[model samples]
Target: MKAIVTPGPRPVTDPSALLDIDAPEPVLGPRDLLVEIRAVGLNPIDFKVRRIREPGETAPDILGYDAAGVVTAVGPEVILFKAGDEVFHAGQINRPGSNAERQAVDERIVGPKPRTLNFAQAAALPLTSLTAWELLFDRMRADPDEEETLLVVGGAGGVGSALIQIARAKTRLRIVATASRPETREWCLDLGAHAVIDHSGPLDEALTAAGERAPKYIASLTQTPRHFEALVRAVAPQGVIGMIDDLPPGPFDSLKSKSVGLALESMFTRSGQGTPDMIRQHEILAEVAALVDAGRIRTTLTEVLGPMSAATLREGHRRLESGTTIGKLALTGF
Candidate 1:
């Protein structure tokens, strides 16, 4: 199999940060599916992991998470899917990922690809969709009938794009998204945000100027530390804030004054820890696919950079690091 592997932790600017190499076929587990990958999606986690995590001495570390593919084979205990089933998934963080020509993923976390979308489109959904879905529904426990406001920061990014659409389709919360640039703001509105505010300024003022109230739920999708204080001030009393980004220890006591609740959402936690409810990811993806097929949701894929190669992936990482991309970036074929 041809796989793109990071030799060690290095910046994306480093020419050797990622390399294209031939690797052996992946071995399967009792509840795994061997997928022949057709396309892959890039996320901030790819570059973050590249900069911090070192590859194991015995095997290379594959860096992709979101992928769409066909099942080539299934493990003995696998019942969710069979050979030739078209599927998509965000493979576990602890496993070899979808940067390769083929990958072994747990069937409990995989879902049928949306029939309305192609491989590249389906690949762009898994990781971001799971993150958004879990953050809004599972972690925050948003009520479908509640009319309270939900503010989303970094509204044009991968997870933000999905968050806006899913919230609009599944809940009644007034969606307020933050985007600094005109194009990004338009993108958020197009995705079903009730209002869009600039994140470059103080978020509380932005929300006020946009005619939105103190949000009952705040999703700080990026640069949490920089926005932490403003978020603490902007949320409603006893409101909840959900975050997925890694943040340094800060003045959490600030939130105490408002009696605000904090929730951390990590899409990898279930599969990473082999949690009892790991199958929830599969159910979430299944619902997302249904939404897509029913025209209630759409893929966030913005551009296809090219085939899966080290140079292409490095360029994708560089673009993500630039922090200006409107939606998800994807690559098709090996």
Candidate 2:
């Protein structure tokens, strides 16, 4: 099988950060399914791992999470799918990933692919969708009917697009997304954000002048430290703040006064921790697939790299690092 594997930990500029290699086809095991991967979505974490290869780990690490593919074979215990079943999933992070022509993924976390979407389009949804779903529903404990104002920082990115749509679908929360440019603002609004605020200046000031009330549920997707102060001001007392960004070392001074509940989302935690509800990923993803088939939610793929290769993957990562991509960057067909 042909694969793009990271040779070693190095700067992303180094050619070895991602290298094309030919390896033996992976063998499937019990409780696993062999998927012929068709499309893969690139995330920032892929580049982060490429640049910071863990010590004592071997070279040629496989580093992808979001994939849409067809099941070519199934293990003995796999009753959910058969050969030639189309599937899409963000499989367990600790295992060998979906960057190769074939991957063996646990059946517990895999979901049926949305029939309405193509491979690349379907590939763009899993990782971000899971993160947004967990952040909104699990961490914040949001109720479907209780009216609340919601804020999603960095609304133009992959997870933000999913966050906007899922919040609208699953709850009555009125969502306001922060985007600095006209294109991004338009994109957010198109994805179901009730209002868009420019993140260039004070977010609080923008909300105040726009007559938007402080949000009770805030999803901070980026620059957590830089936005913490404004979030404290714009977030209502006894509100909820769910962030996926790394908490920088700084004075958490405002947290003391705001009485806001803080929570973090790491979608990998369930699989990483081997929790009892590990199969819930398959459940949520299957529900989301139904939503996609019903046309209740749309794919967030703004850019499609036609095929998988070293150059295309690099461009995807570079564009994501530029922080201007309106949605996900998806690469299809090996």
Candidate 3:
């Protein structure tokens, strides 16, 4: 099959950061489903993995995490889906990704595509949705009936967009999202955020100005280290705070006063560490798919660059790094 592969680690500016070349199509394991990809979404992982995975290490590496496609065939042990099924998935980070004409995915981590969404739109959701879903339910332990509120930092990105909608529809939590620009603020509101505050100032003041009595749960998506002190103040006593990014400096002194619990939300942890709930990704995506099909959740796709190629993939990487994009960016078809 024709696909894009990373021959070796290279700078994004390097012509060889990604290469469009012919590679052997992947064969599926008994627990896997081979999908003919129609649309693929770009995530931060696409760029981060470039320097981490070396070429000619057992097999060449491909980079893309979220995909929407059709099931062309399923392995012998597969039963949940069959040929011609429409699927979408935020695939595992430990394997070859969906940046090609065909991808082999574990059925356990794949989900049914929202009936209302096209391939591109569906492609934009999985990774972010998975992260947001796990962050709210598994980490924060938010209750649907509780009136506690959640304050999200960096609210216009992919996971932030998904987080706002889920918190709004699934829980009574008054959701307030922090965005620095007028467009982003409007985007967050449109995505179901009850209030949108500027992330540029002191978070405590920002939340207060947004009519928040006190945010009892907070999800910090970016700049977690810099916002650590502010997050401690903005959250209520005994509140919970979750972060998804890499390590940042922290004494967590502020949390000490409130008896707060801090958790890190890494979507790939289950797969990376071989956790007992390794199959939970499949379960979560299935439910998320049902919610999307029922119109409770919508696709976060905002940019469709059309088709896949090294040049196009590079541009998608460029747009993500530029940090001006709202929601998600997808490339459709081969």
List clash counts for every candidate, in order: 0, 0, 1
lDDT of 3 by residue, 1-334 (tens): 8789887777788888889988788879998999999999988878878767776653647778899999999999997889999999987777778998888988878888888888998899889999998999999888889998889998999999999988887899989899999999999999899888898889988778767778889999988877888888888999999989865676667678899989889888887687888778888888888888888888888888867999899989888878788999999887
Better of 1 and 2 by lDDT: 1
Models 1 onward score TM values of: 0.98, 0.96, 0.96
Report the C-alpha lDDT of model 2 over 127-231, residue by residue, as the tens digit.
Answer: 999999999889988887979899999998989999999888888999999999999999999999999998888888889988999899999998888888888
Residue runs of model 1 more than 4 Å from their true location after superposition: none
The C-alpha stretches of model 2 lying farther than 4 A from their native spots are 55-60, 250-253
When sorted by TM-score, best at the front, the candidate numbers are 1, 3, 2
The clash number for model 3 is 1
Task: Report the number of the highest-TM-score candidate.
Answer: 1
Worst 10 residues of 3 by lDDT: 51-60
Query: Which candidate comes out best when scored by lDDT?
Result: 1
lDDT of 1 at 42: 91
10 residues in a row with least lDDT, candidate 2: 52-61
- RMSD (Å) of each candidate, 1 decimal: 1.1, 1.5, 1.4
lDDT of 3 at 82: 93
Model 1, 68-176: lDDT tens digits are 9999999999989989999999998888888999999999999999999999999999999999999999999999899999999999999999999999999999999
